[model samples]
Target: MQVSRTATKEDFNHLRIDDIKQPISESRFDALLEKLQINNLSEDEKDFFQSIVEDRMVTEEEFSTLTYEQTKKIKQFTSRSDLEGNYIADSSIGFEKLSMAPLLSAQNISDDEEYNEAIFNTFKKLNLSQDDGISMLNELGGYINQEEKIIFEDSLTDEQYDSGIRYKTYIGLDMKELVSKRLEELNQGLLETSDEDVKSDYKNMIYVYREIETQYNNIQDKNRVENEAQLEQYTRNTKPNPLYNADVVELYNNITHEYEEKEKKEFDELMDKLDISNLNNREKELFRTILEDKEISNIEMDKLSYEEMKKINQFIFKKDEKGEIIDDTLIRTNSRINALLRTTELTDDETFNQVLFNTVKSMNDIYEINNFLNPILNLISEKFTAFDEVNSINFITEDMNKVLDELIKTFDEHYQETEYDEIKEHYLSVINKYQDLKEQYNKTTIDS
Candidate 1:
């Protein structure tokens, strides 16, 4: 009697169609399962088996695990019928051959019915003639295009209803006409009505309609460009319908400019008061952009280098409850505070000490570094300064709180175990030095 060897890694690499199609004997099956380590099987290997059972090709999600040759063979095998039984012709091999029997077919029928009904109702609501409405619906359904309009040829094929494409075009046209007609009615009402409240309502409606007209024109332009690409011809030569009444659009724009003018005036006043003398030309541009936008998006901000962030930290302002700027808003940067919060990232002791020494020597006042340090120290009350008292400490300002919250949350995710005693010693020394510097600065100020 001949003995069969257990399947190895080599056997799995070039799996035969028979290996997949035929079931192995009980002992051989056990050996194959053990060698493959079913529990340890990669996602692709698991998907491969699942695809075989489902009689479908493996999805792109499993592409990373299987090779090109393996994927092709599996697709062919799963798409075919009965290697062990009778062979089916390639023409009718897959289950998808049944006419309009798939799940998407049902969805298409419902969509067509809903859109066709909507087209009829729009014509009725507008009190337009039903003749054009019938023609539009027929065009959308790909029944006929009597005028030979610019439409996708493939979309008008026997089966394709030009469903999504032609429907979009008709809807855009209907909405544009509807908004234009409404704007004209609103203008007539604005002129006839003496009631201030009613006139204001008319103006607001006019503004909204003008906005819709602008958006519709943008969509029309996009579609024209797309059609030009597909048709390989000049679609732009087609004359466009008249746009929204310019008089109403102009009236709305004037109303919008009043609010814009007020905002621009406030922004100019704020810029005039800001001191950007110390910042370099590039830094000045960055600072101006920041103040104008009044935002420092953490995701975009983190992409900046440490030096750039250090500069930004200096200019970060504090905002009050009503989002109004409070005086004395400039942040004083300290490298030690940065290192502590980003401890896992900034690992070198020499670099940390250099930053700490620089901060201590150049410190101008007691409140120096308060904007950055106070929020972090407040988080650990027992180990740090008196955060609540206004005498020496400046508590966490509103804007600083938002910035610190994001940083601390990020740090918590990447935190690691380190020598607690060493970190504690360094922190205590910095706190003592900061307090001593504050006392000396106060004494000097009183004497002067």
Candidate 2:
């Protein structure tokens, strides 16, 4: 793999969590990010930076290496999963850290200079720096209308200067930090500003702050989903097993079907003791984070693999009538016995690592310990709800009052009037349907 000039020398626009684990000739740029005091990222953030680096999410110097077809393949994965659902699961598991999607998504490293130039030119035309252009994505980051777009130098007052500084920081700063700072400013202004207009401005600022906060949350949701997907890929690459949950469950059932009650209980006691459903959410989260956790130099499944632990819990294998692997076709694996051993007790320590575990987890559909839907489901649900709210207008082009009306209508028809059991069941069904649709869509995702 010859490193092209652009891939070798391109500045780190922003390093993603995924990048740190990737493999690219951008150590200079990555080192520069740390040196510049640019992103005060957390441990998880550092993991994302390493992932993209190790994953080679850096720019491609030679367009010849990746054609239009390749670029399309990359973009085509955007809808493969739901992101918002990921954040909800994270929050449920006592994870208070900011989501990874917003920051990670911005670090997309397309090698096409024309694409960046075109995007930058459009932003320049819109009277903002190239940085500000991406930052002001109504959905990715929060936007403030400023009542009126005040031109620079329109006022040198403390309010305008502070707001302008915020505007600039809004474009360049980490989202979570940016929101925290703005809230601090709002609190400060409450004590300092006695004027009505100034007070109103502060009030409007709350709404602006929330929008960005929501977006940041949504971005995190996306990161959760993408992380799961990456884990799925890494898991597939690492694991040697061809079996999935259906196969495992079938084996479990068949083992019982043929064995007597006493023998069946032998494995049942172990499985029941190590109930697969009882694992903590964080333990499940480890599989996805394990993929991003680059601090560990190498990832193998067998040594400390979550799958190996579960697979060995039963410690029994079903045999065919002739004592051969049930599926002879899969026996063609590079190391047939080793592959089968992955789903049994014979897995070796040599294969223990994040990458290998991830592959096994993916094939097994090992979700984060929380039984909640995938993160991608959460993001899509939020957007869908927002869209529904926007669309359920009795009158088109109505303002905030119309939003209130829609909310009133929704609350009245669904939550407010129903009996406890009926409404609870209905709400659960709706949630289930939302999740089911998300799963179906994810499975059908077209890989370009």
Candidate 3:
């Protein structure tokens, strides 16, 4: 008898159609009938209530005139009832009823007989349940379209659109068919057109459509998977590694492949400046083979002199003031000092000695030799001198002595042969520095 003022038709309509005609058990019928008889109701209302219990059925007509509160009470009582009998049973219909019953009956939403038949028949062929079609209809913008086709609301957000697509795909809708069709059309267009610009446009469109088809296929494949293991395998095999994908790699290559004629001219000029004509046949061949895409191997590179290597380094690894390598050319007429003052273990003495000897012996300039040797010299002076006499003697014999002896001999040889005053001065300076370090080492040892 009580009605809620706030209840609207929209709220009432939100209940599914099948829920309106719910059934009641014998015990529930007895209890509800007793309660209804005691309530203050008109004779007609009392009879309506009694008939619902006696028949063990709640119908649409019986529910229509009831207040929202009365309707809610009936809904609760029916839902909790242990339903009996074949009242409005699915067995009466052709197919099994869905758990989520249709919000609106199909006949109520679709008035056009031809359109309804066509759509429902298609749903049947696709193996989609009647509930699936009805649920889609409830969510669609317009259930009765003149075009006899389904369409989503224009105001649907991206999330809603994607959700709709997923539902449609799950229900066996051909989500990718349009995209696949477009790709076939583009393939034909590509073959028909000889114009490069038109061909490019067609190719781009084909790529886009193919990607769309692949995405839909991914969704379909995921949904069709029977178990976790199959899904895991499918995901692992299909997921793209951007670094290794041929299309992605080719795209990046094309972006960075902008080699200009000006760069080639500059390289040629640099080779000419370095007197490539004076290089021996092997050296010339090695130098010529090093290009933007090609690099000289470590074995082949070991054949070059220290001065030649220095020149090549200046050209190849030219760094800006910020130490970032740039495309600008670097022309070095002489090698500059580049000392690496790092700790060296006595255990690695033999390898270090060989590398140092090879590097120094190949140096044609005093600056290059001094620059390379100064770091090693400083390490021994600071680190080795601190060692006790016994340790120092052992370390010197194992590591320091071989490289130091070779370096001193090379410096002496360079000093005697060089005609340049600058080279001679640097050679003396380095030799003197080594002597001072050695004297310190000896003093430290003698006192110890």
- For each candidate in turn, give its C-alpha RMSD to the true structure in angstroms: 26.0, 29.6, 30.2
**Model 2: lDDT to the true structure:** 0.33
For residues 318-368, could you state the per-residue lDDT of candidate 1 as single tens digits? 454566555434432234333322322222232332343344324434355
Off by over 4 Å in 2: 1-173, 229-448
In model 3, pairs of residues that clash are: none
How many clashes (backbone atoms < 3 Å, residues ≥3 apart in a chain or on different chains) does model 2 have?
Answer: 50
**What residue runs in model 3 are displaced by over 4 Å at the alpha carbon?**
1-239, 242-251, 254-265, 272-448
**Candidate topping TM-score:** 1
Instruction: Tell me the lDDT of model 2 at 299.
Output: 16
Residue 395's lDDT within candidate 2 is 19
Q: Say which candidate scores most in lDDT.
A: 3
Where model 1 places Cα greater than 4 Å from the true spot, the runs are 1-276, 319-324, 327-448
- Provide the global lDDT of candidate 3 against the true structure: 0.41
